[model samples]
Target chain A: MSTNVWNGEHRRIHMQEVGTRDGLQAECAFVDTQDKIALVNALSDSGVAKIEVTAFVSPQAIPALRDAEIVMREIERKPGVVYTALVPNVRGAERAIDARADELNLVMSASESHNLANLRMTQAQSFGALKQVASLARASKLPVDISLSCAFGCPMEGDVSEATVLHWSQRLIEEAGARGITLCDTTGMAYPSQVARLTAMFIEHWPHTELTLHFHNTRGMGLANVLAAIDAGANRFDASLGGIGGCPYAPGASGNVCSEEIVHALECMGYDTGVDLAALIAASKRLPALIGHETPSQIVKAGRRLDLHPLPADFAAIRERALQRDAASAEPRG
Target chain B: MSTNVWNGEHRRIHMQEVGTRDGLQAECAFVDTQDKIALVNALSDSGVAKIEVTAFVSPQAIPALRDAEIVMREIERKPGVVYTALVPNVRGAERAIDARADELNLVMSASESHNLANLRMTQAQSFGALKQVASLARASKLPVDISLSCAFGCPMEGDVSEATVLHWSQRLIEEAGARGITLCDTTGMAYPSQVARLTAMFIEHWPHTELTLHFHNTRGMGLANVLAAIDAGANRFDASLGGIGGCPYAPGASGNVCSEEIVHALECMGYDTGVDLAALIAASKRLPALIGHETPSQIVKAGRRLDLHPLPADFAAIRERALQRDAASAEPRG
Candidate 1:
């Protein structure tokens, strides 16, 4: 209800396109490094302020992102685009920094069970790794953003309390000196009320820290959650082009919230997303063949709401003529 | 934020499953009448108060719905489940009445251009036909529910004003004696603000009439609009299982809002939809083969948020054994 919440003056939320890295990571076949670079370059051209290029994890751990260095090097660095990479530890942070990433993203799972299962580390160990990465990025003069995965709910731990998320967020801000913090509904177990409540709590507790929302469409509440976050004064969001990501741990967890769909929804509601819907759809259309399956974006399948394919004026005349001819032919007099 | 609004005490909104009618109509291939009957029977078994069985339009216009009669006859009607059908004209209404349909759904497009293009009739003519159909259904002691298509916006005419929608709604309720009216975003152009504004306007004007909000996911604001409508005191909604159905005239328009998605969103938010999501997903899975295309419903692809597929405890030992076997086989000298 607050018109000022989405005005043009407020620093526009920078949408970070993560389809190339997180999206392609879950594909059945390996997307070549060149294609991944091309996708990132295309996203850069779409006016997205930030693009997560790739993850700097062990090649043996994630074979899909083996060519992260090549992808980072080959991408066309647009004038104002901030290229970021996901880093697991100090070694991964060094790899991202060496690749000249404009920003480094460190993720620590909020759920202890998920942290242990995913990063093979306890909460304390993961926090130590994050601190080390943050220190290294700071030393290298690279901006650091920390994403707290499973902030809303964890697949392993049935329900994750909001207090845990807020506490970790505060720690990430104070201890690691994270420049920005993103709360991830990693398994997409977020309800709209929960999103609104949690986002409001985060904003209230840490009013100065830059906050972002990373929601998965795993349970179809991605856009709904985004709307809730918007209501809670959250603007920055992480989305994948064509909703193209899957959680390796959570089987059947499909894509991240489709970037194009989010942009379309926000722009239509009179919010300034700074992303072109038509160009975003055009970019999404190229992914199905490149990824060997259809992207789950609704905007890609159905064009914009006002998009019309008008029938030519003479089409009815032609049909009428054909009908008249058929009627004449069917007459008995011949 | 009024809990009493959706507390299911004074007023409760009912969902009429239109999968059998609208869902089947959109499919290119003819779903077997028996299969339709089975689906309707299954929906009847669910706690949904109403099930729209089939449309009684001309077989020449839509061959997909030719077996409406058989589908209506075969469905096992439950005690409180009201079986309904779409009646385009007096003839269709008569047919529906003869088929023992509990309610007759009469449709009239609010936009004259769409009405003419889709129904081959002027707006006046369509209303005249609707009046006759409503009268016939009333004479037969059958309930009549009116659906105003393009109530929010039209494909031909970009913006359909609230005045036009309200005028037609008033005409249908007062002149035609329609029991209930559904405002349809046929091309899916309505925003949340628009939905809230229109719903508040309608409820204020037509305090005694039953109001239902039917939306499409063409622009991906379907659920958001539903939430807005609920916030504005609208109770009833029309949704298709697996988000089936599209307007033939509205090019590139996507399917109806998925029933399971809506139900899941509402239920998780503590609103009672009176529909089982797991059962709804089970029903939706049978649709791809029947419709000859994969459905766009998210719940079918990724189950509910609380749905857990926990790994068997012994599976970890099996994975460890496999890892050891691979490591041993990789040894060169041994």
Candidate 2:
């Protein structure tokens, strides 16, 4: 009944391409450090506000990103594009700072079961580690961004309580002074209502902190969650190219929300994302080769809505070629 | 910054399963008549408000639905479910009535290029035909539902004007007494804002008419458009099972939005869809055998978020084998 119902969020949205890190992290084949640089450079050219180049973790922990420093150093950081890296601990923060990362992305699962399963540490241990990383980030003059994995829900545990999310977020922000926070739907268990509720809570509590939404299309609700966040007034998002990446815990599962799909939806709705979709799409094109596999991107499978297909060469004569040629004859036997 | 942002449309939503007709129409294989009956019967039992059983076009028009009458005659329809049939012309309407189809779904593209290219007729000719069908439907006591294909945009002609959509809808309701209308994103060109604007306008003008949205996931915005429509106060939708039904015009392109995906989203957001998701999912499982191919349904690929996988057989040994092997490895990195 009201026109103002859906346009609550009409401001410019910012996208952070995390394909080079989050997307390729769990892949079996090791992408050449040179290819990773190329991907990051291309994504940087797309006018994204941030590019998460790589994760600085133990080489044995994630063999896919063993050359984290190589990628962070090799990428040509464009002006205005913040080059960030995923740091799991103090050691990661040191490496990211050494590589001159503009921001340090520290992650911890909000769910206790996932925190143990994913990081081999309790939530308290993760908080302790993050506290240390936060101090180092402040000393190095780099912003510390926190991502609460499984904030929506967990695979090991069915539902992560909102109380748990709010409590951890308060610790991560109030105690650690995180410059930004991402409430990640790690395995895509998020629905719109949950996203709206949590986003509203976060925005209300920490009005000054940059709130980014990180969603996986594991259940095909990734873009849907993005829409919900937009309505709830969130601006920053983390997305993967070509929808690559899978949880090492759950192989054959989808990774992050496809960056192309997110930007495409926003741009279509007249929202200025400041990212060049054509350039981002061009970057997504190279993902299959870089990752050595076909992608799950819908834009790749189904061209842009404006991309018109040529009419049939025999459009005038094709009516007789329809599959229902015998339907008349099959009708109730005269 | 307020919680009153997105809770605008909290109401009952209805799902119409169009898989048996729209999904199978463009398939290469002709499903067995018995399978069609079984599929319809299963969907009926799933608590869906409507089931589009088959199209009554000339068997010559779509040979895939050659057994429309037989399938319609044999399937056990549920008491509350409305078994609808697609009718292309007067002859199709006659057969649909004979087969006891409760509703007749008549369609014509809004864009003239799509109308001619898809239906092989001009817009005015389609209007004339629909006029005749509408009068017949009134006489036979069957509701005439008109679908304006490519109402959002057309693959052949690009953006169909909003003025054209409103004009045709006005005539269909005022002149033909059409009971319901469907705004079809035939090629998945619809974005959220466009859907919101059009839905709001339709709701404003035809306050009492049943406005249903038909979207294709061609560009991964099908569910997003559904969200926008919901925000704009539309409660009815048409979705295909297993995400079947590719566009013949754009070969290999996705067809209607997956029914499971739509219902999953609505049910997750606390809207009462009335249909049982587990039952719908179980019915969707039989589609591969019935259609002789794998489907694009995400729930099948990723499973529900609540469907947890068992922890690995080597869970204890695997954690000690994490990629980040050392908490002390980051002690200033030497």
Candidate 3:
């Protein structure tokens, strides 16, 4: 019944762009390595806090990101932006380190079935593997962040328990020495209330650790869930450029939370996102040609809320007729 | 700064469907009269609190709803569901009353330029005409509700002042004998903080009056704005089936807030929307066939979050291989 629930705190929000890794991995046409570097370079100037540049998995495992090492080594890195790479094992970690990534991002699913299905390993095995990757990253003096996929729910397993998610998060930090954890809604199964509960729980348990909330717009609750997480004290998020990435299980479904749309919304709501929105949108505009497909970004489709449309061609005539009608009606009906 | 901002109050939300009127009015292809009746009947069973069945405008103005009278008279009205019709003037009010509509919805824009462009009348002229329509409805004992379009922002005028919106709302209620008001985001310009401020202001000024929030998903902030309005104590919303009706000024943009998606979200968030989500989705699925185009409803495309997908075809083999791999990796340091 409280009406004062609008948190117009104007706090800082950390936006992480994941189009190169999470988004490109699902594309049907492979983007040229130079284009990938260009995309990352464009996003770098947009003031995003972090950028997931590429994944160092096996070329056979994910051929789209086969040029990950080259991409990591060649891009003009911005000073304030943290350039990260998704690493699957110690070998991947060594490659990322050699290529000079700012941070090492490791991945596993909170649900057991998703872990096996996605990574061909049980939860325990995946944890063991990621632990070694984390250890290698730590030994190389690099910060390691673990992304726990399906933290909300799994398409194969339905609902993954919060206890299971928290358990893995605790281990990834306590044992693997991960400095941060990302709760990823891998299949867009998270709703706002669930997002609020989980975000609050995570922030309460680990106040000092870096927390990022990643969502997909698969069910159209992406922005709503973002607001809920922000209300529950989450300041970091993962977004994809042009809203590209998550494969549509059915036609017309959306992908990840769009970077430009999220930045636009946060900026409108008085949040300090540190993002140059016009610059971000310009980069998003090239996604369709680069990816050979249209993206689900609403901002890219319909410009920002303040972007006014020109008056209809007959507007001056229409106004004149309206005034004449009003004057004639005032005089009285014959 | 405040983490306890998620108001998970299990309140009852009144969902009013406007697809048959606001949505269909903008379509290039006209839906058949019988089909409109069928759509209304289907939604009647979905437990929505109200339905804007049709608009009683001149066939010249909106040829799409030309058979409004026949459609209204033919539809099987359900008990406990109010059937309303959009009435632009006294003549429209008379026709709506003759068709046995339960309520009359009068509309004008909060912005001057939008009013002239959309309704071909200045603000004062439009108010005078609607006041007469409201009087006619009052005489017939049918409740009159005013819908103020562009209450958030005007597409041509940029930003509509809140003072103008509140001024019109006050006149429509205090002078025009209207019982309810709907703040319409005609071109999807509303953001959350703006929605929060306006909704709270309206609730504060008119605590006893019925208030409905109408939104478009043009910028993908429709549901986020809905959540913000709810936090500010709004209970009624106007949604369109299949997210249809708004003519896309740009390609790949959405129209109105989708009924099934809103019901699905509120139900997930523990609010009692009293809508059968499956039945609503069933109706939304029929939109493409009836309208000859795909709709923007996410639930219609991807199914509900709880609706799990079948495991991948090679899952059993993949699981066996994964187990063996884990077993092999457990024993080794070559």
Candidate 4:
């Protein structure tokens, strides 16, 4: 196997922040353009390898991300940090190119039902549209990546087969000339064995392509799936700040894997997730006020694992009392 | 090396429900004795291997569990399920023995500071008292298990070494003749690598003893740690319904790993957890009204992964329109 990732050997892990695009797109309330810009800038300062900055889809479809062009253009891009924007069609691709995005993320779903319900198109149509967008981006010399939603299991159609996922991935990579593919667990149905199996298969098939694993914590298996993917040799992951983001279609489902939570776990496991957890957590703490609700970030709520709490106010007295009791119990009479 | 738990090999996993003891112990409001007995009865029908029914500590110390004796007596003990009770000293052990508890779980912290702050005694005092409890339980032919709190890390002291944990476990297992041991991530400070290392060592040292893992979701690493422990050969886990229970001393920390969430994941991963998940979830859904607060259970909120959502209302019409649009586009439109 590919040098078991858990053999006490730490390696560099590339974390991509997707809260701005995937997370914001699902929110009902529109975040101000300036706040979005500020969030992106803060993430740029953190050491995430990439940021899915925004989506260039029709504003009518995702009013929450209507200020995508402005966000893409106004943010002060950091060197070495890839800024990607979601594009649903050639028009969105043109907009992303105009906004100077570093990469174009073409979107579609692996499951036909999800693709139809989500994109208002069939899987064939989605591939045809995304292929054109990929060609357009390629002509503009911008790297294009495909995000296959419901790759693991569809909320409407349970258990999308591994063969189906690979078939779609093959077409996306070979036919569309995509540089990377992210298998999105849209409703967090992925288990560890399934993740390991698919990750290993995908890596074996596309050894050189950038393969990212995107998971949702809807079922509380997000971090476990991440560990499984890492064990199977997939490094890149998409995480959201404050764990804010869920499938708008799946009510009661939790958001994306919490960015700070996953980073803390990876760092503790000896992986070098270049991002500064303190800076990221500081940014995450701002989400409750900014989003007008609480996000599901455990690390944000509990602080880092090592963030020590002060002993009880009467700790000295308690210790003194215990010591006295211990001494008394050890007395000759006793 | 231990057959790789994720090698697609299915096995039976033993799940222990600890909501009544560990979960309710930290709750401020008192769940009535009748309600406690009903909760335990519900879990008994859910196919869990064990239920930590109640704690036999002094009622003055934990008024939330003041009805422990009544709860223990009234819980209609299921034949196959082992009913366990937490005992802090000889008096508690005697009470548990009188209640006809199937197992006596003696608890103490691995860290000196946490032991003093939490149990109001030094580690030596806690151990001495627990040793007596174990011997008393042994004399009564009741199985004894020791839960080493802060086995992963302590909130006040931080990073309780594996060496410290193993040392205490050795003393409890060898000196006290304990039959089982639980390594508790009392503060949710465990990461996967740390769990893997410690579990392997613990299993290696005490191959014949039943090793149970108790984890908190304080940092969102609870389930991930569970996966790691399983990979390292641990089969028993302590989980709570509704994910209730946290370190009262560490405010803001999340509760124990959600029993339904973990069972759902394990069942999905092909492991026969022996849990009737639908029944377990039914019981978990009762937590909000019963406990008078919302729980942190993702499975209870999101439903099981295969609990499919119905297709959108206009899905047929949408698919028709997409198919018509695809035909038009393919016909070489001018």
Where does candidate 2 stray beyond 4 Å? A1-10, A247-253, A315-334, B1-10, B249-253, B312-334
List the candidate numbers ranked by lDDT, top first: 3, 4, 2, 1
Mark the regions of model 1 whose C-alpha exceeds 4 Å error after superposition: A1-11, A29-35, A74-80, A248-253, A312-334, B1-12, B246-254, B288-293, B312-334
Categorize the docking of model 3.
medium
Tell me the tens digit of each residue's lDDT in model 1 across B185-206: 8878777767878999999999
Candidate ranking under TM-score, highest first, comes to 4, 3, 2, 1
lDDT of 4 by residue, A255-307 (tens): 79989998999988888889999999988877777778888888877888899
Cα lDDT of model 4 by residue, B33-140, tens digit = 898899999999999999999999889999999988888998887788999999888888899899889999998999999999889998988888888888888899
Provide per-model DockQ scores.
0.30, 0.36, 0.73, 0.75
What TM-scores does chain A show, candidate by candidate in order? 0.89, 0.91, 0.96, 0.96
For each candidate in turn, the TM-score is: 0.88, 0.92, 0.97, 0.97
Candidate 4 deviant stretches above 4 angstroms: A1-3, A332-334, B1-3, B249-252, B330-334
Candidate 1 TM-score to native: 0.88
Question: For each candidate, how many residue pairs have backbone atoms clashing (under 3 Å)?
Answer: 0, 17, 0, 0
Pick the winner on TM-score between candidates 1 and 3. 3
Over A242-266, each residue of candidate 1 has an lDDT whose tens digit, in order, gives: 8889865445545699899888877
* Candidate 3: pairs in clash: none
